[model samples]
Target: MPQTPLLSVVVAVYNGELFLAKFFACLEAQAIEGMEVIMVNDGSTDGSMAIIDAWRDRFPGMLVIEQENQGVSVARNTGLAVATGQYLSFPDIDDDFKPGMYRRLLDLALASNLDVVTCNGNYVYENNRKPSRPIFPEDKLQSTGVMSGPAWLKKALDSRKFLHVTWLNLYRHDFIREHGFKFEPGLRHQDIPWTTEVLLAAQRVQYTNERFYDYYIHSASVSHKPDTDDTLIRSARHYIKILEMLEAINQRYPEQVKNIPACNWQIAKEGLGILHTFNNMKDPQKKKMIVKEFFDRGIWRLIWKNARGFRLRWRLGRRYLKLKKATRVPG
Candidate 1:
């Protein structure tokens, strides 16, 4: 057996042959010490497995595990089971980090003793597309901010200011293990529930306004695609469960913002996106019926109950969307 590592970098690989070499080239150059790379092959039929094999000699600290094709969640869970790192992080196969990122993150995590530390990532795209607005600055390893548990989530949910992905955070493995938190397996939007649970349980969370991770938005990515029926149902279920989870946390700490703020924004944001997805279908009746059924299914109540913004904005947004739709309606 190889020596124990101080940090475990979990990677869930699925058909990532194209970028594997570039990713490892960056990985091999990390300045961080005592790091182990735990990668799971979710039955990649492509040459991803072969690529890992080739790099095994150079990355002797690398731990590779292969399983039948499962969702990213399962692959992560599998990696977590055997990870010896006190701190943990995951890098999506297509994404790469700048040099010295791992060392910087680990140094901050150890020195600060924070339950979680996250930095901003630069969004890179084809033809030099970057995010319109960024929440964090470039390459900052140390971050400082106010601390709140349930109340913090309420504020983010209230203002509709939240991070959608979980990649940038360096998680304390012990904290996560104590809380018994795991990613929702075989489901879309797994990060939402996982991150929500961790944030709610955190006592000291920090942020670094740095750009260590590079989020490459390829056209084939899920966020770029239109939502299907499965996506809508999955998102609705995820919100419902996450709300229940947050409410339970609120009960324990009711003195915070949880006393009055409802989850309207989450419902509205998630549900309306689903509604917009219905438009792409060729059948008008299908779109209309799905929209009606969404309301009939009592989804709006969840949205209505949890909304944090002014009622006027909701009304205005609803009207604007209607006009946008009307422009395409057949005369």
Candidate 2:
């Protein structure tokens, strides 16, 4: 039997031919032994498979899964099911990371027996039009210490800059499996709730100041695309689900009192985001439908109940009044 690899990198590829070569090149540069790369090709019509095939020989532990195009959430969940490593990472195919990134994270995880280890990264814009920006400020991570996951989450949320992206961190396989944490299939922004749950459940989490990952921002990215009526509706629904998930988590772990306010804040943010999306929608009929749906689902009450701080509550109230008057929807 083969020894278990130290880490597993699960990437969901869908029409990512353009970036596969460079992504593979970055992985090769890592030079980390006993690292398994699981590539789930979600029915890519492009030459993505060809590029993956060309690089198959580079990693002895590489595994490839081919499946129908079922969206990224399903693709990632598929890869997560079969991963056989002590640690796990989910990275985008179109992104690259600095050399020695995983090695350092793995070493830290091993040394401290951490449930989750996260590091900083840069947001690299396409065409170099905008300069890269560090995901976290150096001052925020200067302590470089291990703390409870909820504690770390509280600090991060207080900073108001915590990102929910999965790729910035490495998680213990057992911790993930023990919780049966799987990305919701067909749900956009699944990372928000997933990350929140993981952090809340993690007993030992650490952060490093090392800027390792490069999250490339380009016009072609799914997030950058202009929101259509369908996409907006989906996004609104997704945020509503996130708010509900946070409430459930808060109730499930009542001892995590310090974490509850932050969680509620997250709920408020998502609620406001939904309201903003609804307000910006171009179609009046669609807007009316979304407003009615939000009220019917009691999302406004969720925001009002969970929203922290006087200013935030005031903003929510003001926005609700404006939206209610504009749409003539019930208070």
Candidate 3:
């Protein structure tokens, strides 16, 4: 009988032929025992499948699942459904991790019996042409050692340096399954709400300052794509949805008093992102429609109610008045 692996790394691949070799090389170099890699190919039209097939021999424990182009959420959820490991991680194809990253994380998780363990990483820009910046700078994160997920989240939010990326953390499989957490299908910027909920439900969480992963920032990356009408509208709607989700989470976990401030901070930050997206929209008609929806949904009131500081509240208020004036729409 095959022994259950210690860790399962789930990867969602889409037209990733250009980076598969480097990614595979990094994985091979990890040299970690009892680890399985589950690669979900999300209907790539490129030679991504061919590259993955060729690399199969190098990674015998690797499993591949082919599915239609249903976006990353579905691909990741599909991988999670069949994963047979003690711990789970989701890493991007375009990214790489430092040596011993997973080994160290796994060791810490086992030693502490933690539900989640996270480490810091750097953002490598344009394939390292630009100097990389630490995702969580030294001053941005102060709390260390093992703490409940909600406590960790509150401290991180208080520091104003919380990140929603899932790739930076290792999660216990049972902990995730127990909570019935799954990515929201077809939602852009889904990580924001997903991570929020995960942290809220986590019982034992640990944080390390060690830099592990390299988040490559390239023009081809979805985050770097030039904003268009479609992108703006999608982002605006996504932020609104995130705010709603955060509110729901707060209501569900009412005993997590610490989560209230953290949730409010996240809501304010997402509201700013929505305002920025609205400002960048090219089509006046579309922008007006979005503005109307924002008002109709009472998102403006929500933003004002939860916005933290006076400065942020004032800024949002000013933006709201300006947006209303520009759109010439009724309140």
Per-prediction TM-score: 0.80, 0.96, 0.95
lDDT, model 2, position 246? 76
Off by over 4 Å in 3: 127-129, 258-260, 329-331
**Mind giving the per-residue lDDT tens digits that candidate 2 earns over 1-331?**
9898889999999999889999999988888788989999999999999999999999886899999999999999999999999999998888889899999999999999999999999989999999999888776654459899889888888788889889989999999999999997887788888888898899999998889999999987988999898789888888888888777878877788454588888889888889889877877777777777888888889889988899999888889776776567434
Locate the minimum summed-lDDT window of 10 residues in model 2. Answer: 322-331
Q: Quick one: ranking by TM-score, best first?
A: 2, 3, 1
lDDT of 3 by residue, 171-258 (tens): 9999999999999888877888888889889989999989989999999888788889887888888888888888788778888844
Candidate 1, 1-331: lDDT as tens digits: 8665767889999898988998888788885677888989999999999999999888776889999998899999999898888888877878778897877777777887767777777768855665533534322233456455454455445445566576887788898788877777776677866776677777767666777788787876766777666665455455545554444544554555344353335545665555455545455544555455555556555555555567735753574465346335453
Q: Could you give me the TM-score of model 3 versus the true structure?
A: 0.95
Per-model RMSD to reference: 4.9, 1.9, 1.8
> Which TM-score value belongs to model 2?
0.96
Clashes in candidate 2: how many?
A: 0
Question: What are the lDDT figures for the candidates, one per model?
Answer: 0.69, 0.88, 0.88
Candidate 3's C-alpha lDDT? 0.88
